[model samples]
Target: MTLPSAYTEAPARRFNVGERVRVKLAFPPGHRRTPVYVRGKSGVVERVCGAFANPEELAYGFDGNPKRVLYRVRFRQRELWSDYAGSESDHLELEIYEHWLEAA
Candidate 1:
């Protein structure tokens, strides 16, 4: 089955590369693009990877609205895990949707 165009259009971006942002600490149920481990964590917007249908919403069979902006966010491994074994320079990158983020 073919999805509508809204599912593939470019979303109006709310962030920029190199900008700091905080992921929402939410755990609302369903298929979310943002991983649970990264919730409530702070990171830098590494790149704006364009928009796509909101997977969280689409998972329920609805045509996603106002497409979500996908961003590659970089976070320090130490920040995500207090007892991380990696070096301070070590980091993890995640592709998070705009709605899941806030200005840091």
Candidate 2:
């Protein structure tokens, strides 16, 4: 089956490479894109993935209002995963929607 176009459009105001950002996870029974593993963690903005439809809306049978920005945030593996086995500089990149971020 084909997915909705709102899920595929590119973002217009994504975070710049090397910028610092924080992820905001929705709380209380919401299964979210921002992993629980990374909550309250600080990371660097690595790349922009651009805007797409909001996942929350789609979850409730509504066409999500798309935001204008998205980002690829790079966090240290040690910061996210408790049992991370890599070096201190080892990083993980997450494709985060704009609404999930704020200035850090």
Candidate 3:
């Protein structure tokens, strides 16, 4: 059974502000929280948003124990899409878990 998000806490934190990182390209079944469009994309960490229960694990009815660190990653809008029509200065930011991010 799934537990409330407030029941657990992250045990560790990783990554840092302004660090270049890439999102892992994954399509695992069930309880997914990452966006497909951002997969395999590289971006910079804008801020460390502290740890929270792992949504990926929570979706499956686990405790989501040992919460994961969440980061505010910034990516160029053009990089996320192939057909770009917006201003070049446009950007997209997302809150990504540490497990979904890696050094670029």
Worst 10 residues of 2 by lDDT: 1-10
Question: For model 1, how many clashes?
Answer: 0
Candidate 1 lDDT over residue span 4-99, tens digit each: 223333446888778999999999877877888999999998777778788887999989876788888999999899999979999999899998
Which is better, 1 or 2, measured by TM-score?
A: 1
Report the lDDT of model 3 for residue 89: 85
Local distance difference test scores for all models: 0.84, 0.70, 0.82
On the 0 to 100 scale, the lDDT of residue 3 in model 3 is 20
Task: Rank the models by TM-score, top first.
Answer: 1, 3, 2
Clashing pairs in 1: none
Ranking by lDDT: 1, 3, 2
Candidate 1: Cα lDDT at 55: 86
- Cα deviation at 91, candidate 2, in Å, is 0.9
lDDT of 3 by residue, 38-69 (tens): 99999998777778888987888888877888
How big is the RMSD of model 1?
A: 7.1
Worst 10 residues of 3 by lDDT: 1-10
lDDT computed for candidate 3: 0.82
- Score candidate 2 by TM-score against the native: 0.74
| TM-score per model over all chains | 0.86, 0.74, 0.84
Model 1's alpha-carbon lDDT is 0.84
